[model samples]
Target: MKSVARKLSAVTLVVIALSNGATAFAQSKVTEIPVPNLVIYPGDLIEEGMLTQQRVLKRSIAGMPIHRHEDAILGKEAKRTLIPGHPIALNATREPLIVRRGTLAKLIFREDGLEIIAVVEPLQSGAVGETVKAKNLDTGLQVVGVVQEDGTLLVEGG
Candidate 1:
């Protein structure tokens, strides 16, 4: 009978320890982050009023760019559907597309304080400030350039 009582005591002690550990974990710090009001579809830019700060457990912040600036993430289009009350994960969104494939794009080359202008047909589509492939219409030479917000492509070193 005494042995059985000791075994029961040990189990009780283990359960108490586990409960205390869980309590400590629950009391850990949490932070508030911006979340959407509704399910945001892909390619929809996030607006300021669309999000509100929500308190979430610190563990959820892991693998997320929680420390990024508001403007850095705001106005970025969602790459996937974002559900309400859940913080948008980093890389879940991107800048809206500015250049489309098979379109004629103004290409600029900046070299040593000299600017050269040319027209190229883009072979691939890309968003503003993203690098994309474009082929020169005249020479048929393929070149890579960053798509500017003003529908211009900035090719480095011609």
Candidate 2:
């Protein structure tokens, strides 16, 4: 009788241990993450109204960089199509481009208290603080410059 009681207690301990492990596994398998409420196409700016939170299985999004909060997605431009009720990938969005291709932008060069400004055509679109290639309209030369906050390209030594 003592042997049977000992076996029953051992089984109970194993059951308790398994239950705890299952609970932990369950908690890790599911999480709440932000998802788009509507289809978001490339170049569309993400807004607060476009996002909603939903519980998602971790395995479904394994190895993907996903946005967990609505704040991370808002005010960003979509780089790829975002499907509704799915995880938003990190590479699927970007900062909105301030300088667009084929647009005229001011090119500013400053050195030793001297500044030269000229009009240039942007060959590529880029956001503030991004390097972009532009054509100097007056000289017809290709130049690379950093996009400034004021929609100007700042070129160094050019």
lDDT per residue for candidate 1 within 59-133, as digits (tens), equals 767767652345766878888898887777777888787888998999999998999899999999899878999
Clashing residue pairs found in predicted model 1: none
lDDT (Cα, tens digit) per residue for candidate 2, span 37-124: 9999999999988989898888887787888778888999999999999889888999999899998999998877788999999999
Candidate that would win on lDDT: 2
Please provide TM-scores, in order, for all candidate models, with all chains considered together. Answer: 0.64, 0.78
| Count of clashing residue pairs in every prediction | 0, 0
Q: Cα miss at 16, model 2 (Å)?
A: 14
TM-score, candidate number 2 = 0.78
Q: What is the lDDT of residue 102 in candidate 2?
A: 98
